[model samples]
Target: MIDKVVEVVSPERALRREAARRTLRVLNSGYGNHGASRTKKSLIGWNHKGGSPDDDITDNLEVLRQRSRDLYMGGPLATGALKTLRTNVVGYGLRVKPQIDADFLGMSDEEADEWERHVEREFQLWAEDCDAGRMLDFYEMQALVFLSMLMSGDVFCTMPMIERPGNPYALKIAVIEADRVCNPPGVTSPNIRGGIEVDQFGAPIAYYIAQKHPLDSKSMQNKWARVPVFGERTGRRNVLHLMEFERPGQRRGVPILAPVIESLKQLTRYSEAELMAAVVSGMFTVFITSKTPETPLGEAVPLEQQVDVTDENSYELGNGAIIALGEGEDVKEVNPARPNTAFDSFVMSMTRQIGAALEIPYEVLVKHFTASYSASRAALLEAWKMFRMRRSWLISKFCKPIYNEFLYEAVARGRINAPGFFDDPIIRAAYSNAEWYGPSQGQIDPLKEVNAAKIRVQEGFSTRAREATELTGSDFEMIVRQRTKEEKMMREGGLLTNASENQEVLGVPGVENEE
Candidate 1:
């Protein structure tokens, strides 16, 4: 036999190999720490592969964009998160109420009242027909389209029927499905632009909206073309692109569900497995053994001798049914897989993370309130911060601009009275000034909250108008007018309000007990 010799590498190569191996070892260690604090986010083993908070999102936006939107529509947790957010964000509908800047308009109280009435009348008339076609009114349209933005990451609105017959102000908004904004006809990609064309400043210069949805199977789908952001012959006011921009330079929106996609998939799988296991646990399997010495125990029985479950007797195995076994045959109940004790804890844990990912508290996301009052209220307060912020963004991006445009068309057509409407910017500002009120989060303890509000108002820390609007989603001025009418009517009927009666009871102790 030949002597075996171990080949030795050069010293330099040995050191290089050792360094490479050490690098890999460090990487596979499941910790990206360089002697950092254990509590530091990046050093956490679970978050090792995740990019840091400072990581630039512009580079990978396009990659995660479509898939995130798809999962938001089809994935359960994704859909729930979107629906939950949308409900809180715009469910009550941001009701538009004209609030003319009195100082800017230099109008007296009586003139301002008239101006408000005229503005409200014109606004209601236009809003009734502002939605695309005659199908949905403005509020319904807002909710539907807002849901799309939450689901698809972006939505397109076109003013195609601006000058529709019988419609005043020539203001109409038609919703275009997000998928239509794609590559130009017969082109895969030239400049890596996904329907949006941006200028050198990274500002949106034009939008390429296809006539048909990109995934539509119709034969005429190929005929759809991309339209410019501002049509040269038509005009720019015709198109509206709404997207939730996450990064400074990012062009398109990534779905709100992006962070929870993987978790949703795993949760779905776990739920399905549990359901299957539950079904199988109720089932029983048959085992047959021969009692005679001629046939060995556990020996396979001949086909002809084996018992068969005919269709007529199959019902015996069904719920609440009893069955008789063949001679020497025994029934062995199938032991169902033990339901994982950690299942609920695991699902709740996953949902908590999902809620965090969506910036919604778990209680709000699930609409569950089994927690203590303080905890529940705290969760709501925290959740409302995110919701209110999103509402502000929605107002700024979609509502406020749309209203201004509506005002422009209304004023141009003389639908609303506006002296010097076109002459001065201040007049326009006063005319366009408005507030959108949504549903109020009513107090759980009404009297306590009401007393607190009254105290705050008296102390000049709050205003009745702001508090009323926040509590009722109503116009404070309109409320006072209605209350005055009710009081007059009640006085004529010889009835008095509880507030007046309470004045008589002042300084009296236990009047009810005396009575």
Candidate 2:
């Protein structure tokens, strides 16, 4: 029996060995151990003494070393392993099983089926490669790859602001990672291991860490300090600092200036901070005007007419005070400013120039300004009253129209079978102030009214039937007699007009009787 068993297994074993040999040869060709000595003394090392060592053990070790080297050298085996590892790791299922076994265990049938499918795929891949050791290596690779993916930015997570009544601009500025925690199922926890506790099932059940934005001193220096000073000038002792805060670098304690410069450049067009910086740097320019002398030396003309102080290039001669920027030698006048009769004419002129550049007409700008405290309070009260009144008015106007239409349609359709439609509180309130009214007593009982109308109609038709009988001509009688005869014949032949034989006969067609 032993001989037979060996004979059967020997060929299969030989085939597996041949396959492994071929795989090892392909791997080694790509990544050979270039520096290792080929001498037997160098190759032989530790040996197990329990039994005769397998001759193929050395070859297997060499193959494993070659595969590891291939991966290190950025070869195909390494790439394949990485790709497979990533897929397996990201695809692995982690779920929170409910504490109740009956509720949770059988509840995840669909999920369990999906997981089984995934495991089957892994098994299929493993089966294709006959080496069990490589299959184990793949599992280890899967775990490492999954950890890396979890650490990456694709996860959704959030951190709390460091400051109370936090700066809106700083809040907007903070960068958030993408692969952080999400409320959705299948996403991994974003917190550090010590911060959040996971259940025995590897599910995050609770968090211990305080939510906080990580702050770096160098990065947040401008935000924390009223002003940041870079270095003092030697002579004047003037402090200098960068216009904007620096961004934190990946390495702890380092700061990057590029983001600050980019942020400043982006702010230059619209932000007041950028404008203030420009003004302090003396990049801005301004203009001023001077008054002219009353009259020329030998002119008989009136002083006002004859007065000519400067040409349009300097300042237009007038009591008017204009200020503007200097365009080459010419003065380009801006809007005029209020001239206070204090200080030297030149200083006053400069003040007027500055005011002119910034000033806007009160009538034009006052409307754009928000109302101050007292005015705002008055406006708010007025708005509240108006809103309440308008709402009440709308309810009154619209509800009545809807109610009337509904009642009218319901009556016309013979669908309303009960009384008190008008007596409904909603309807009574809506119609309280109406000048014209519907029925003042009460709504008609619809079912009774319908029955009465139906009875009257029947009675009227019966009276008409009697009139027709009294005035019956030979032709009309002949027609009715003929129809009656035909109906009787049909009934006798087992073909009746009525659906069922048990049904009572209705009154004659096109005829009525008073009784």
Candidate 3:
């Protein structure tokens, strides 16, 4: 073998190499305490699997939906939260206000106004009779749809055109509950998750809907209908899938109460326990014990004779009853200390947390406005922001699509006058531009609110119509017309006075800014 010459490293280089190795070890360990495994008591068993969005949500969806529904039915807080959202988000119904683009259509202001009025009236006519079951109008259906979404996480709506003698429009709304939409038994596909079939890009292609609810005992639940996302003939969407997506590729919705189901259940249990303790304390029964083998009080009845105490060795306390015990038997007065001093504080704290999760201020959520006027107004304004956001979402997803379809059919049927609606997409969209108005935010201090609204209009920050809509849910045009008629009557009868116009009625004056 050839002589091997060993190249020895310098002392400084060796120390640098050792230091580099130590750095690498530290880097390999992880970025922080949370990123590394630890045997500490708080983190020793924290082994939860991280999953894809669909894998995490779709897999656990059913149980989550069930628990959410159960909580809504049984828990007071859940019911209140659901009701609050339903009331604020879809109160009454979202009424449509046609906003046709007059400039593009080459129409005068008067022409546009007339056209809008005609369209609104026609839409209302169709909406009144649009329900498939012939029970609820479009406005009422909005509430049902909202409540269903709150309860079931999502709701599906189908608009099927069916001929009716009295109703001019054939469009009708048929609401499908969430339970009826599911993956059919014995059917499996890589593109399908939670009954929604998607393409390679994760866009929904179709939905599989069962003929009956899975839990319905009288019907066959396994039968499913595969509905394509768009109609094969007209290229219009056949089904309206109303769901708020929370993930990039999520195919389904999580229940509104999903995040706080456990909390709601625990709070409900605590409330019930407290109520029961208070009730028991109010019974106020007296028990007598004696060393001798006789009733301490002659009028007292024996515990065994009064109640069957064999179950768990428990005694029932009755109203105005004196219980007696035998010799050597003693009863200990275990005070429950009910009407717990901390009950309200604990409950308020828990409610605040839950309300935050639900995006509802505590005052609005519980309908308790005992706070100062500023505090209450702030709570309402905050709640209204969420309400407006949800309303916008509902309008974008549900209202606009339906109205577009309605406009299309109306134009095709020659009910609405439009020259190039079918020929051009731009014309169609311009014709379909509209605003949906729901319940107003409502006033806490009417005088202050009215003054603020007036200032907003005067500063060009808002329009009289918008202020009227937001403040009182009234149309500014209608208010002006009514006011003019009243003034004419007053002038005719010589009842017109400066005081009536200056002070205004109830210290709230009309907005003078033009729309």
Candidate 4:
């Protein structure tokens, strides 16, 4: 009975042990197995029971504990847990709270993993939005500011009263013209059949008008608020203005003008903005605009007052309004014009002085003259001639050395041929005068010059001879020693000492010893 009990108990214990081993293996296979030894070959140990209680499985336990720690400490599992928690706490539409992981023992690895994933998802969404151009960076904001200023049309104007009435739109219009010049593809002017030719001076007339009448709100609005539409069939000068048509409820039509006006406005605005920005940025070292004070144009008649129509008030001047005045106004114009003429005389004198200094022809200076004051052409010519005479006298007296230096440079560069080289009259005349001897007190002697030239040639030849002799001395000495040794050899070999025999050996007749 004791043996039977031992046998039954032994097999039963073995079966139980086998089952426990399999259970442990299954448990150790998954991610959550915390306490199982990873190195264990079989789950059973110490006589086929199960895990030994005395055997330290602390290393395996530590590994499992660490893995669990990682899961809760902001790993994927923790990230998922946080996401689920957020969803449950805040509902679907609520913004998910950012995952917060604290490295504490109380936090589970699953919670940390869920938190990490949640943060990652939020960042990814942000990156996608940025890539899709939904956000503006620093440069974009700057561009928007510039565009707003351009669209506002107030950028180029400085008039505090531009919000009022009766201002001329010339300056703004001219600015548009300049812009057309710069960007011709985008902006162009129309061809008027008999309109005035627009030169560079005329281009800026709009700006002058703006300066004269700053209170014109219509001008300001027209300058700034219009968009231009170009039609292929339509004339380039007559761009369609959006401001011309208005909806029934709208108060004002969009004001548009020639493309030239738009261009001028852009240029003026850009220049003004650059100037202002530079001033604000502390880039300007000098305040130049305030240096010159503007003088007012004296009492001038209004454009309407000068009109010649019998019914002056009743006459409406269309765009082609030119007033013809009686002889009385033309005579009165001469009195105010004298001061202008005197001013022009003073300017001409100054210009002639400057032209003399620069050695430029008076005609060249006259071509550059463009001023409100007018001077007589003959008077200007007379003044310029005197100026040139004075300059010649000054050159002869004070600048003789300078003249000599120029002559020397010309001679050294061989730009002027030596005398008698060519038979051309100009060439002969250039070398004929005593002045051709340059600034020297006396005439140059060709014979003495030739003697000096020969001395230079002889010196150069002697220098070459010395160099050649020094270079060949060692080689010549070596050749003489070799010849001596060969001659001795020939004599020892019982060769004849006659000139003919020696010539045959030395390969030269003169090299044989006559003795």
Candidate 5:
């Protein structure tokens, strides 16, 4: 029995190893990998197959992005999904809640508090009007970036006003439309790779920004030039190319709607088909003739002139129009009794697929909450997680870098004071340390969720400031300050009880009575 078992297992193991060997061979060839390959096959250096899973995926990205943008801008499901993302993830705007962490710099308590407050105010003012001419603030600029990121694969933000005349901060970020990113004009140098100039390590050294969108009607869209990653005059990072990377060495972002473009197209077709079906189902076809069924004399005139209906003067069945048939052989209504039998079910299924690709819930997409409360809540929570993750990414990638640059400018211009601002990297980091917060995803059941968060804080598992930040995207210190100020004003204005009354009723002078 033991010998027989060995005989069966030995061949199986050999076969498995052989299959793995072939896979490794293909991977090594496709990945352009050399020494990583081994005589004994291994999965460690394996590369993905089909459509060249490589660093040079810019061609695929561009093609998919154009099609994806068309569908998103026009297709119903795509439009709804995008709208849902913007409403839920961005909502009003991702407000900048900067907290200059002087505490991390080991400053005195009083000094830290004052410095943080002062810097916060400075940052806020700067954030209010980021444009050179103040057309849109940083908040509004964020919406454009995210929307373009969804529609196009990536977006570019060039500091065109880094040294503009009359610019206060010596910095101004202009949101370049995503359509402008393209191959550099005229020079086919190998260094210029995939709509961007790159270093030997595949890092983007510069970008080619076009004068006009390729699809724009006014121009043929063939003019572009290489814009440096940093300024020629100052070497400061003048151009910031924002893109979400998936595979290693990818230079540009793949549109978020890329995965579901086909689905959106099909959904649009389905909607049109159902609409046509309903139109066909609405009217009756009338067969008109003379009482004796007047036969065609001989040579047939045009088919339209052959049929002599009394009310042939365009029976346009619209709003209040009615069709009156002549004394005919018969008047038969050819209305389809069943209109779009599979419409509801099909739309639900396809939209669910689309929602999954868009990282939104089907219920959210259609605004249908027929499902159980628990199920609906679960779907919402899952979608909210994706939104929260994306928001964090946005803040980290774009907001943090921009804020750091703004801080440097602020320090340079004597707007904010830092004891060791230009000295040690640690102090510089502490000075630059700030949190960028957006809108929070408030819980479905606020009472229950708030209670849980309260418990978490009381148990020392979390901090009140962190909890407050998560709930409202505002610092707890700032919140408390505002609350204290409001309470003082209200008490002074005779709208609230004194501290004694608050303590007697709520057991805490700082606590407020609920209305």
Candidate 6:
């Protein structure tokens, strides 16, 4: 028991020791217990850093855009995603219907209706000839903008008033691709992010647009123009930037394929590999065995004279050919077992995950709806929800703004009348309000869908207008008018005798049989 010495620890060392112990204990508990545990083999090398949305997007924007375009061009799934969106979201492009506010303009219902019709006609006249290049109409331009945004992450349009021959409206829309908008060389500022200059509150102030696309000519790439957000005198939007924001401060749009890029690429590679394997496996060759070269392998029989032999050791396989083997060489049978038995299941599993990421259901993405009726209908309904959301976004980001500008120009030129549109913001918004229609969600079972729609309308759960629009993408009033005209025509032609008879022929409800 003689000379035991007690060592004293300093307060700083004691505190440090205690803190380390506590940190380890915390790491071994709760979500961090496994997820944040560095001691585990799985998560030992897992490391991630956090950054603002702009930092994450702008830092890798170029690579992201190029890769997305490549995948769209090369990958079938990527192509399907793009085409599906275009077909559902902007099929034949969105047709605009003016919804002017009657109360605000102090006009009766009839007056408002008449005014809206006039506005629509005038708008169409300008819209048909709105393209600056005169190549595409406004509707086709909508498809271009939608596709550009999906492919390039963002698109820019300059609404410059140009007096072109044979075009009544001076407003011409010139579509610009994403590469045209960029940070000018040797111009760096705290306010600029990806050529979009924003104010302190993160609102866009202006954009720097190059005269020519970067890929077009290197010499013209440096020629840039600083276009302000609005006209100086009129305060109208001069540039329309179509992008969907993921984060508040994000100035640039991420491509639609950004989130699923890696998955799509890997899937494409896997598909190509599988396809190559299947093709290779389909050769069905039968190799001959020989014990001695002198024994002589059977002569390479030509199926016809069309077969060309390039190698002595190899011969072309025929429909039903017998071959003899040389002595002392045994045939070693090989089976690649390609066209992998698990290929379809594995691909579908991966596709489901990718479709989920892209907000597309597996059935819709692959156009495979072999499931039960309920299941197929559910998938369609889910896909329609996403399509509708994207359609709404298109309306807000691209369609409405351009239409508002066109309407303003039309009003200024005395083509359409809008009272107090310029003086009050509310009135201006009302006059600019519109309903955009696109292709409808097609039916699987028309009879069932029609009956359900009928019941919904009769029960007051939905309106005929809403049902008609949802089922057929047709105006309810227009349908009603057309049906009335057809019935009158049929009556005049003796195809219809009475209302009950007509109802019986058409299978319409609310018809009583005459005794």
**lDDT top scorer:** 6
Predicted structure 5: lDDT: 0.72
For model 4, residues 1-515, the per-residue Cα lDDT tens digits are 75466557797866776788788766655433433545455634525333321122211322332333343343332223223222222221111122232343234667644644444353333222221122542223222222222222111211111111332211111112111111112233432101112334332112111122223345543222222222246312211111112233221111111112333334335445555655544421222122223421223245565555564333332334344533323212111121233544654564455444434333344544343222334434444454344333323322222222223333444543243324454543333221100111111344543454456556775432223222221223346678889788877787856767887877554675665
- Candidate 6's TM-score reads 0.85
Residues 1-515, model 3: lDDT tens digits: 11121115365666676688777764534434555645345666888677887788888878988888898889999999998998888888899999899999998999999999999999999999999889999988888888888777888999998889987899998999888888888767888878999998998889999877887788743688999999888899999989888889888778899888889999999999999999877765445465764433334445656666565434554556654555576665656677899999999999999999999999999999999999999999999999999889888988899999899889989999987898889988889999888889969889999999989988999999999899878788779889878766775676645555533532456643231
- Where does model 5 exceed 4 Å of error? 1-56, 101-106, 132-134, 162-167, 220-222, 231-235, 279-315, 318-331, 489-501, 504-515
| Residue 139, model 3: Cα distance from true site in angstroms | 1.1
User: lDDT tens digits, residues 1-515, model 5?
Assistant: 75456558797766776688788766645334654544325644566344532344665766777788788777877887777777777777775554556467777878877887787788777776678656888877887788788777788887654454444666677887676777765667776755688889877778888877776888864778778888777566867777788887677777888877787898898798788878776755444444554543123334454445454333333334343444433444565654867789988898888887777889888878788878888988888899888888788778877887888889888888887877777777877776666677656677877888888987999998888867776778777788768766776788666556645633344665553
lDDT (0-100) at residue 377 of candidate 3?
Answer: 93
Q: Residue by residue across 59-101, what tens digits does model 6's lDDT show?
A: 7899999999999999999999998888889988788888887
Off by over 4 Å in 4: 1-375, 398-401, 409-515
Q: Please write out the lDDT profile of model 2 over residues 1-515, one tens digit for every residue.
A: 65456558797776776688777754532223332323235443635233211122211323333333333243322233333323322222211111112223343656544533443343333223322222433234323323332222111112111322422111111112221221223334432232233445544343232223222234432211111111234121111111111222110111111112233233222334434544544422334332333322121333455456344223232234333333333333443222323423533343233222223111111222254654544433343343233223322333223233333334334443223334465432322222111101111244543454456557775443223322231133345668678667767786664534313332334443221
Error of 1 at 186 (Å): 4.5
TM-scores across all candidates?
0.78, 0.13, 0.85, 0.11, 0.77, 0.85
| Shift in Å, residue 454, candidate 1 | 1.9
Worst 10 residues of 3 by lDDT: 1-10
| Model 5 lDDT at residue 509 | 40
Question: Looking at candidate 5, what is the lDDT of residue 109?
Answer: 76
Native-structure RMSD, model 1: 8.2
